[model samples]
Target: MFRSSRGLYSHIPCPVLPRCRLPHCLFNHGQQHQTKQPRQAVPQRQISNSASTAGSSVYAGKGRVSSSLLIGQSEINEHVSLAFKGSAKRDAPATESTVPSATPTKRARQQVSVPLESKRSADAAANFTAAEDEAKDSAVVYILPVKPHPPALHSQRLQLATALAKALRDNKLSTTPNNAASTKELEIASRTTSATYANTMKQHIISLGKRGKSVEKINAKKTNEIPSERILEYIPQLVHKEWQLEENKYLTALPSQNEIEEARAAVASGYETCDRCTRHFKVGAEGQSECVHHWGKPYRVKGSDKKFSCCGEMEGMTAGCRTSPRHVFRITHYPRLAVMIPFRQATATGNNFPSAVALDCEMGYTTLGSELIRLTILEFPSNNVLYDSLVKPIGEVIDLNTQYSGVTSVEDPGIPTFDATMNTVLAKYIGAQTILIGHGLENDLAVMRLYHKKVIDTSILFPLDNPGLTSRGYKRSLKSLAFSMLQRDIQGTSRSSTVTRSTTEGVISNEGASCASTLPPSVVAPDALKLEGHDSIEDAKAAADLVALRVKFMLALEDQKRAGATTELKIAT
Candidate 1:
């Protein structure tokens, strides 16, 4: 289960106000907001959208989510903005009545705040007229100028110095006659005293003009809640120790079915990595059968340090309180994989060898391991379905893995059996030259007993940089990717109780399910599989589209770089 962070890093930096040294800051007041990483190419920023969804497999980008500790989710960030136009005169304080609770008359006259873009006033600032411009509609605060103003400046140090300086300059100069010698000498002495006062005033003015940034920095540290930016800054180092690294020596980037089979026979015999707990165990171990896990992804609640599991439990409070009848293991070793009845690689007969392909599968817990229940494949670029079907699994049916998968039944008389379907249906569309696409297909490929050399995994393509959450690492959900990249929402929504049939779009199969959606607050039995299912066809198309979008972004970035270089060369000449 997972969601991506649009908080901290997603908010646009405050607009520069040229000389914004006001007692009351118009921009980020108390928070220590940092600008996002500067992109060399503007479109790279758009990658944030496409990051979750990009990849290719005839059917790829599984949105099947389980109690995965490697995939993380967090609250979407909301931008906060406060702006004021500089309409005050060169220098004069407002009357005491003008300010809500100013201590003295001097403070009232000097503190002037012009509202930012008010239709009611003809002189509103045009800088932030549009609410949704770059700031994404930073919470618009509409404070009327006629209303009583709150005490603006909080830093006592600046206030005291400012008031003292104003008093010295405004009052008439008076000297004691006892201190002066001759009239001429007194005049020279008076001039020297005046310069000293002028210099001191200048120094205080400079310090006060710095917009209280130093004071704000101190205030930020005292804040009780952690800032979103601080959370983002620490994300990279938060990768879970159990999470597999991209360069893990235990497995190759692309291991073939044969290699995995050999490993199963030699070293990792009867061993499996549980999809729920991420613990390795012998398939038949006594204690291994029971799995205590959350059926949903973990998320960080906004404004609170408290983290929560999607299943409605405080994160880290317990080691997955919900117990499953069977500790379903994700098939990584090939020998233990379920053999699916093929609809036949009927499309393989065609001479056309697709360059790109996306794939997705649905699965159920079986005696042998997780078995493939449904498979969907789509051709790249065109998004034509090369193959799609429901298959009978190899083991005795246990739980259908439906809480995350959303698949309710295979008992419909229309469901096809091994004998009814033709074999080699997948071999037809995917060939040596074809590049397979999916999101986190490692587990899926093992179920298919395939270790394709040419593969484009969305999890690898657009990894979640944040690893601070318990359920996150490099991999993210297809739903997150689709929403981020394609700007379209998919999965669960399309597959309702009325639509569970031979196939659907955005569904995760038994093999490598990657659903990000979570179960409801209530827990359901494993056998129930009551959750809404996903569509492989929908995810497949998204994977292909994700890859295509990435390619286009890269090309555009290169073109922009070239244009910039050429312009610079002309100027140098």
Candidate 2:
């Protein structure tokens, strides 16, 4: 193997033979080679490049040799032989011969035939080399080293040649003065100016390749002319000037105070006197006469002289009487009024159609000092069902029994409370401005702490005639009113069980004893809750509908009374 300077190794030229030297191995043939010189090993260690061992053949000098050597071992078996090619005079036998014993005479005989053959081959090899040298000499030509150019000749050769060529050109009397001037100008231009020298050599080299010399004359004074960028610096100011010009063309004129006042008065009169009939108009009423009217024109008129004159003379104004010729006309303004409205009617916030809304409350009821829990309020006037749930009390108690006017609870432990379900019930049915009609809603509002004024209570409408009956005397329970008006009982199952003291205790015991511990309390007598979910939306609707129904009935009865009581001509019977 051969290694080159680039750290690459040539492939092994041939497969391993027994007597061949390994790249770096200790053993060869039957002996281990020893070197007397102390030298660093090329690879620091000897490695066997091939796996061949005893009996493996090593081809050397036109014959095969066998290896039976071990690394670093002294014992060597001498079976070495010499092989030689045949000469023109005579040929030796080709068969290999092995000496039976190691002896000095036999070794001498084995080596003696090779020296005579080698002397003859040396003479033949010298004759071959002489012929090769003679042929090589015949193919070659000799070259000499180049001579250096003269210093002055090398330095100015280009300039001298250019000037000499120009002078050699033939001149005639017909030559224009412009040509001579141009040549003189080019000579002066060749002298470097500060402007030309300011640019770098590389920049000039690149530019010279792309473009010939510029025709525009360069002056030393204008080396840094950046006119394009200078113009860019003032672009914003120029744009602003253009914008001001355009803005002035479309500027809006502002309305004066007097014009604004006149506009307001016109609007006021428009509402008061109908545009179709110019007279004071009442809602839900018929007009006496139709009149032509103006909605008023918009203008930037000076002074508030919005009135126009009629061509005819004024009735009250005469020559002697001192009155202005212009007659004064009065304009009336209509006031927006509030009236009793049904829950189904939309509020004055001007949402035309009515909508259902939910209500809720937080109140204290259970145990003397228990925390106030949320009370449920549900109303759907369109559906006519009210659901009010009583929450089992659980936060800071701010009031006692009846302190929060309208909460009632069930004795059953498993029933879900108002606090748990009120929000769900309210969001499902009610919205902002729902008119929740209840009796003495002040108490409900106090417990709820809600501040909506859309609510209307029947107790406020029905004040006592005796003057002694305020809330305490005339306040009616929903159940009592329902019973009186509809002649049907509307009972809450939890009401009796939650009533005070002995009555509540007895009622709970009776409910518990019915199952006799054989079943759960609910199995014997299931809770008879009318509105089972304790939802606020259902309760608010029921309450509002109850009031609306009563109002409609009362209005019908009054109308019947007026019809019956009216005096008419009596016919003779």
The candidate that achieves the highest TM-score relative to the unseen native structure: 1
Question: Candidate 1, which segments miss by more than 4 Å at Cα?
Answer: 1-292, 302-310, 316-323, 333-351, 412-422, 466-473, 492-531, 558-573
Per-residue accuracy of model 1 over 39-108 as CA lDDT, tens digit each: 3432332222222211110011222112111111110111111121122222123343343332223332
Cα lDDT of candidate 1 equals 0.44
lDDT of 2: 0.31
Once model 1 is optimally superposed onto the true structure by TM-score, how far is the C-alpha of residue 502 displaced, in angstroms? 11
lDDT of 2 by residue, 1-573 (tens): 342445322233333444344444322323323333222321112111111212222222322222321111121111111111222113332222422112224343333233423433233233323442222111111110011111122113223323322232211111122232222222322343434522332343344333322212223223223232332232222111222212222111223456545555554432343322234543223442333432222232366533322222333232222222111122211111101100122223334323433344434422221232434333333332233334454332323223223334444575444444434334443445445455555444433323344454544433333223331355455555545544534434332222221222221111211111222122112132232222233233334445544334333444444655663323322
- Name the candidate that leads on lDDT: 1
Q: What is the TM-score of each candidate against the true structure?
A: 0.43, 0.24
